[model samples]
Target: MLAKRALSIAGGLAVLGWPFAVWLALTYPELHILLPILALCFVLRLCALRGKTGALSRAFKGLALAGAVLCIASIWMREAQLLLWYPVVVNAVMLTLFGSSLFSRMTIVERLARWREGELPPEGVRYTRKVTQIWCFFFLFNGSVSLFTCLAGNIHWWTLWNGMVSYLLMGLLFACEWLVRQRVRRRYE
Candidate 1:
């Protein structure tokens, strides 16, 4: 449990680091390298996998790696425009997904879903439902916003790709959450 908790924190940091690193690497150019980041990610994933179920930690680790690559790419390509505001996106994800963990009880679905392993249980059905809905809105907004930024031609490749991935992943999770809720409600009623 402690291990998983730490993994979540580290994962959280990495998530926050995404845009900052992307901007720094892009703007600072000659200073960044891909190998160390990849290696660190691999190590974190390995550590995270130990204390938690295979499914949960692995997904985050994957997200970290994918995110790191996108960041590195953005840096290589010199796209650092959104480095400052990227934390808003990170905060949104953290609050919606992780913040829910702090208040919620062990959600039956989350327990089964494997995404909530190291995190606290959801508070209740209402909390879970609301969080899911909020995430849906986030995805829809970010997905569209990132693409628009991409078109404006100032955004880094990293930001665009990361935004797309975030949007897609959140939308998928939201749909899955909605379906589970529907099934549960139908079954119970």
Candidate 2:
């Protein structure tokens, strides 16, 4: 279990810091070979979830396949830049997960809250749904920015946003949400 959690965190960081990894790989051409292997692993792991329910899981499976295809193409073309698609695909999957949860019986935020707080009040459910919706929009916007950076033909900007700015923005949003949640909880109390 601990290994799983550690791997999960490492995988997430890898995705988030992909642009930097690409930069390093570009500098050392020999590292290019590893990109497709990592992507293939992700594709297999996602494929393993074929039997999982939920639109989000299905979307991930499809996205992972797309990523794997791109990875293979990059390998064939000897284009390390193609690795930029990793974050774009990941953001889209996240967008789908958060967006789909808005219409589900329980939004993602609500599920996390429930795991920690058990039963929640009606207001909490509404709040969680709103938060989930907000995250959906964030992912959509962030994904667009990521795609734009990838296509803009500038590695510096892409690395800056994907490796640093994006995470800082997400952290700010998370911190702001927590502050608002605390105030709202106090008001309800």
Quote model 1's TM-score: 0.45
Per-model TM values vs. the true structure: 0.45, 0.79
What is the per-residue lDDT of model 1 for residues 129-162, given as tens digits with 9 covering 90 to 100? 5654565466556645555554555546556456
What is candidate 1's CA lDDT for residue 51? Answer: 47
lDDT: worst 10-residue window of model 1: 82-91
lDDT of 1: 0.52
Pick by TM-score: which candidate is best?
Answer: 2
Residue 102 CA displacement from its true place in model 1, Å: 21
Among these predicted structures, which one has the highest lDDT? 2
Against the true structure, candidate 2 reaches a TM-score of: 0.79
Between which residue pairs do clashes occur in model 2?
A: none
Tens-digit per-residue lDDT, 1-189, candidate 2? 565555455445445545777767766888886676667565555545546775556766676676667667777888878888777887888887888787778988898899799999999999999999889889998999999998996888888888888889899999999999999999999
Can you list the residue pairs that collide in candidate 1?
104-121, 104-122, 104-123, 105-121, 105-122, 105-123
